[model samples]
Target chain A: MAAAEAAGLIAVGAGLAVGLTGLGAGIAEGNVGAAAVGAITEDASLFGKAMIFMVLPETIVIFGLVISILAIFVM
Target chain B: MFKRSVRKGNYAYTVTRVKAKKSHLLREEDYDKMIQMSVPEISRYISEAGYQKEMADLAGKYEGMELLEHATYQNMANVFNSILGASQGELATMVSAYLEKWDIWNLKVILRGKSYGLTGNGIKEDLVPAGKIDEAALDKLISLESIDDILNEYSRMGKVKFPADVISDYKESGNLGVIEDYLDKLHYQRLLDSISPYTQPTKIFLDYIRRDIDVVNLRTIMKLKSEGIYGEKVMKYYIPGGMQIDSKFAQLLANAETVSAAAGDMSRLDVFEEYIKPVLDFDNYDNKAVVSAIKKYQEDQAKKMAHMYPLSVLPVIDFMVHKETEVRNIRVVARGVNSGLGRETIKGLLVI
Candidate 1:
């Protein structure tokens, strides 16, 4: 029972951190997205190019998600 | 679109827009070609590309240098205010404040022009349209009856103190630096106060400011030292706010701090070393010193700021700096062709 309880606690903590990490990533990505779209609005031909930079920040959140899944599911 | 200060999600949208515009900036090859074009050819090249609408609008109203100057400021204002419009909350807030650097430039133009009896129309052509204050506010500025009128109007829109008494005194003396210092000091104080909450970001931001201050202070020192103005008087007009050039540092510098000590403290303060050290060296370029200093200011600030966190602000800020440099280089090339200047003069003005 104690072992099960400790695992549950660990899962909840990682889950919480993942949630906060998403929030920070959202803030980070928000700025890039705004600038990306802003550039597109000036010239639509930039759509493809802007998309690349806009997606660059997604890896941060992906890293967080990977760590969280490793901690919860790998065990 | 931004009605509030940037908070969380605002950065992504703005950075998105900035990236698209970044691709359109003049490449080095384009600049090379621009150097060889005649004035009309330069105008035609711009019209064929992105500057068409502005070139058309300005083509009739002015020509040569005047036309180029007006179109540049208009596009610049549009881009700057566009960033503000696209941002909201804290993101818009910081961008708006920094753009105020242009207002300090504009106001200096006005006060100096007014002192020289240059017409309002002549003075108006050079003004950049950003700086957080509204167009209506800037319009009110151009039509003002007195410097006090400008001050009172600015006070309503923001927290800048208008040195009304100083304006009156300086009007009689016809000393332009008095008015320049007021605008400079007000802008610097506001910038410093705004960035207090974010320690690392503020430090990084102020380091740019310090490097900028060092350049201005050094130029003033050089000019004064040559003109026989005492260091004390030179120090007075030298606005002291930068970490390295603040009051005590200025005094120490005035007292002849070793070039290494001054350079060491400044490099410690920020990556300003790249900008400061070149000029501090014994064999630094004496000709076109201001152009080099200002160009390094723009380029280094761009590199340092590109890595800032919360990526929204940095991308926009980076694009604006790059765009401004682009316009400036084009203008330099255009003017060089008109004046029969060699490519070296035009190239000297280019930041990239």
Candidate 2:
């Protein structure tokens, strides 16, 4: 019972961290994505490079999600 | 630090997206290449680059400087107006107030041009698309009989308010300086008072702006002093809003011939928060101090920007400023190339 309770609390903490950072990652990526799209719209050659940076911020959320999932199953 | 999760996803996303867009701006290589090219060649170069569609589209209606100006304004409008529409909450509130600054600038342009009796075409070229006013409204405003008419139209539409009545007295007094000061004070007051942020990002942004204002005031006082203009009459144009440019600062600025002298004489600040802290003895160097100080400010801004990855309000503002500087530099380059001017003169106009 003690172990279960501890795991539950840990899961909740991970969930909160994921939620916060996930939103942040989204917002952070959003700025770049819009800017990239804007620049690309002006210049098509810019499209390839812009697309890369736009997706770069998503790694944060992906990391957060992986951490949360790992915490749930392993930790 | 701005609270990433505290804000709406939509707002955060927009800021991030805009930040990415600022990265693709023309670098020094492009400008160097452009400098060696003719006007037509430059236009073609930009066409082959990012401005292809815009150049092709605007090619028919305009050519040369007109085309370039239109392209620049349209692109600026499309980018910034999108930012204005996309963001929500406090960030939106702050950016919106700052954007409305264009409205103030537009109004001034309208007023000054009208006062000078500029031709319609003359006034139109100077009007950048920085305000909420649409093209049609701007056309109508330009054709209006008086500044009062434009203000009245805005008031009637409930789109905005103008303190025309307050400005009227100053206008009648035959001192444009008073009217200009009144307009600036009211604009800054409304701008600063309306935007409240829960995040430190907001504070930093406002401090940056207020610091910019203080520098402008300090520079203005310096310029006036060098010209031997003094007394309460000339000082009436100066406002009291910016922190460092208070009474003591103003008095010292108005009195000192050089920056080092001013720094030595005034209550010395251990740190100048917003602007580049002037180097020791900068006060004594006559007119040259202003240029050095401005360069220092730019370098300081670059340092701050280097720490943060590209995105947020900073990038957007940075792009606009850089674009303006670029445009000014290009104009200098264009004129120099066409007229066979010295490289030093052209270099003076170019900012990094």
Q: Identify the leading candidate in terms of lDDT.
A: 1
Model number 1 iRMSD: 3.5
TM-score of chain B of 2: 0.79
Error of 1 at B145 (Å): 2.2
Q: Which candidate gets the maximum TM-score versus the true structure?
A: 1
**Which stretch of 10 consecutive residues in model 1 chain B shows the poorest summed lDDT?**
B1-10
- Enumerate the candidates' DockQ scores in order: 0.44, 0.20
lDDT of 1 by residue, B1-352 (tens): 2343335336666776676667777888888888888888887777665787787798888987777777877877887887788787666767777788887787777666666777778778767767776667676777776666666666676666666677787768877667677777777667656554555654566566666666666556555544445447767777666655667766655544334444444454443555545655533435355446656676767667777754546666678878888887788788778888899877766777
RMSD of 2: 6.0
lDDT of 2 by residue, B301-329 (tens): 63475335343455545555665555555
Q: A1-75 in candidate 1: lDDT tens per residue?
A: 999998998798778768877887786666667666666677788889888987887787788888888888776
TM-score of 1: 0.76
- Please give, for residues A1-75, the per-residue lDDT of candidate 2 as tens digits: 999898989889789769988898876775676566656654578778877888888788778888888888888
